[model samples]
Target: MQKKTIAVGNSSFIALIEDQHYYVDKTACFKPLLDSGNFIDLITRPRRFGKTLFMDSLRLFLAINPANPGSTAKQERLFNGLKVREDKNFCDKYMGQVPVLFLSLKGVEGSSFEAAYRALVQKIVDAAKMHAYLLDSPRLDEEDKKLLREYQSRDFMRDLANIDYASSFLKNMLFFLARHFDRQAMLFLDEYDVPLAKAASRGYYNAMCDFVRAFFDTLKPEAGLVLNDRPVLKKAVLTGCLRVSKESIFTGVNNFSINTICSDNVSLSACMGFTESDVLALLDYYGLSSRKQDVKHWYDGYRFGSNDIYSPWDVLNFCQCALSSKNPLEFKPDNYWIGTSSNDVIDEFLGFLTEEDAERMQTLIDGGSIELQINDELNHSDIRRHQSEDFWTLLLFTGYLTIAKHAGYKKYLLRIPNEEIRNTFRSRVQVRFSVENRSFAAHGLKLAEAATRGDVGGMAKVLEPLLKNYVSVRDTATKAPAENYYHGFLSALFACAGNRINDFQSNAESGYGFADIVFSSGYGTDRLGIVIEIKRTARPEELLDAVDNALKQIDEKNYAECLRRMRCRKYYAYGIAFCGKNCEVGGGTLREV
Candidate 1:
């Protein structure tokens, strides 16, 4: 089957139509938005979920004729056969009827706050360039002409001083647009939070936040300002990933109707990710209906509000791969989402996980859920300074994990959404852990051998030195920064033995509950199995008690039941306790002492 050309990163609604690219008609979104009457809406969604494309759709729908300012003939063909055509009233009311102030801050990336700000300023300048006709409009007065001509000034790029003083691009652009069109302007901002997220990761969050807020501050009425002096922004729409608490970015703006995955309103849920109908239609179109369940198990687990939506990007990429395969079953799912973007959230947060956090992650990775307090509103700074459930909130916001169950208000039982994210967790841990000293990684063999015979003391000695350097000492277990460091290190050790690590499960089901870490030597009468329970203690004095408790839990839980059922020759269960730089290992056969 020949695959239709996918608009992977193409954000142009017009281009998608003109080039006949494969697209899901999200123009239905234009109605609820029109009915809401809320203009300054910030629709937050994870990356590659059609936010940018939607922004483009809205721009084309509202934009005055770019080729002929007095007429909208050219833009009319762009929406041919789209969903918006069903609503004759909406089409007559909005299609290319208003002046548009469009700006996309998605490409703004830099090392420092100033550099990023410069790039953002450049984007603003380019948006003004898109409306160069505003300057030539006979309706514009001299004051507006001065403002529009300032945009054409080449020296503005080098003049950071002027940009710093008067840099509300949205405000100035809207002002000029309103005057030129002799009516209020509709503003469209795509990936509005991209700069904020990038700045947070780059250590310029506060500065970027201030700039962002300052820019938005112009959108509202200021003190000592009359109706005439107010911002020209009428119905403005912005799209990005994080909502970033009202106290953080949208501090003063209360008019915003934010639609996130957790929102009570399900109207925009289908608008974010591809809905079930969308997946079904695409599969049928591509002649891959037989593999629907397989595709669902892989790329279709994300929950937005109350709707289940597949990642449009992943689904398209899956089709791209499936088109090359002779059979749908032959094409396996991979981390298609992570492949196109940086895993900054995963990579950065892994370094801060506490013993408990890492343990929870292990459980989630092994197809389990962990309870967490989730705040739908979050900032990038919260991610860095946070030691609590906010980490899960950020991950959920970014689509790495989804709500497995909502326990209560601001509380959720989260788990990895599908095989793609699960593989990412495994791969990231492997990279972060296996890159340490070769000698330390080599110790995994010795550690594995000791576990085979349940040499508790020997295993403790091998891990003690490694923990001293790798363990992050949190006064409590709620936040373990070095949780992944040691867990990954230990896993890497077992992994060093070639295919032997294939039998390892960090939290595998066995007796009644689950085992912390288990290693089985395959199904053989002579083979041996190893079970280890890990516990973290805040004080060295508690190490012994912790080890004792772990061993008792292992016994009580019957963690070796699975291996025993497999008819293994014998299996060993060991208890390991960690306290800062000290550790005490226990449990083994009666003779191993």
Candidate 2:
């Protein structure tokens, strides 16, 4: 494979440049659409998934007919030997008979729905004028001529009241063009839900939803009149990230079909870019076979239904890096997917944190699943009702989290995609969790450090302060329960010190039952394991009994099986009993056996 210049930031360049290898032949995606001859279809795919490139490919293929009036002879040369060239039926029936109204809604990010809706309509109107220029027909009725002039004027608000009504203006314009050309008008909408995502995240979901609902209403059956010998509206293909389910936004559209990530009808994965064979061949040409598995691990888990999809954006970036560098690992890790959204939205969602939620989050961090119940109507108004799974789903769809697996039907278990997300989440959680319990964290840190070093005196010094300040309260009204404080203190300790010296497991399965805290660390040539038992009382005899019970459980359950499997030179299990933060270390004596 020859090294091709990967084009960036230019939509036109992606479609027309084949000699320079700037274009990948994804014309295979047009097969189903062209075969079925559907007038309108909506496709929902994540951002940077080649929606723009696919639309541009369609534009080039349609720009070649004499009936279309803008047939550039040079543009016809661009599609030679492409997938569409082999389709005899497509060439005869649809190659150049219709005029296409192509528009992208990707650039309309706004502070509110009204502002964004206005910007979106302006873009569509501008696209209409550009198409009109391509048509170059001076002959028109007064009403058609007026519509064209009004479109050029760009005061779409006067022509249409709301975003929904705005689509009527577009439909009318397309209707007129089809009649003028004596052909059906084909509509290709790219990144159509961008405005909706922006508005929903910026506090205008309902307004945005209403606008989109009205906009799509124009495509309803018998909504517009046919003009000249042309069909008023012939076909449309709309693509975006979220499906915005018809029950949610697009109502009353009886003939439309949705091509989504989970759709059985569309092979959206291969529609975007290169196939697996293409990737392997490229790797072999570039001598990157060794790094192929690593690349797949990071970017290959995206599943569009059962057909696993790879991010075309990442694949391109990787190819560019491979061509430019001798070192295959030179590409820097980046959260490229999440960079499209504002950080404030992520921060705002993280702001609603509680201690219980923190504990649950820790379990998830350690590879546990969280269940979230979904309701009938899921909208921005009920955003706060979102459970952990809802937030995880949002993160997954938005690219913060990647779907690890589909657990049954609707349940999607999620995990951080790469080290970038993992590290970012870890830092954010540390700051938030530490802010509310600075002093407690400090005290717990001291105790954990001493326990790691096996210094009984140093541990007592820290334990005394915790008992006095937090655990010494006898009146239930004045303080939290002793058990609650113990759990919290242990959690803070594990969080702050576990990464450094101790391997602690909270609510992890042990021999007979789950253990509260099992701290293990290695010394010069030996290993030490401590099983901590927390209770409400600190009597000497009671402490001894608790310690004996913990040791017996450890023996019964083979809790040290992990250490033994690792073939440690030595091991010891110490049981420490705690009451209201005060603890005494007494357990079965350390023996070589």
Q: Backbone clashes per model, in order? A: 4, 5
Q: Could you estimate the TM-score for every candidate?
A: 0.71, 0.64
Query: Which residues of candidate 1, in runs, are more than 4 Å off?
Result: 1-3, 66-70, 223-231, 326-329, 429-593
Tell me the spans in candidate 2 whose CA falls farther than 4 Å from its real position: 13-21, 37-39, 64-75, 134-139, 155-167, 228-231, 284-287, 326-335, 338-340, 343-346, 351-385, 401-407, 413-593
Give the lowest summed-lDDT range of ten residues in model 2: 372-381
Give one digit per residue, the lDDT tens place, for model 2 in 201-289.
55577877776776666576566566654447778788876656667666666667776554566444467634566566656655676
Per-residue error (Å), model 2, residue 49: 1.4
Cα lDDT listed for each candidate: 0.73, 0.60
Model 1: what TM-score? Answer: 0.71
Residue pairs whose backbone atoms clash in candidate 1: 352-481, 353-480, 354-479, 354-480
Top-scoring candidate (lDDT): 1
Per-residue lDDT tens digits of candidate 1, residues 474-511?
Answer: 52344455334445556766765433333677777988
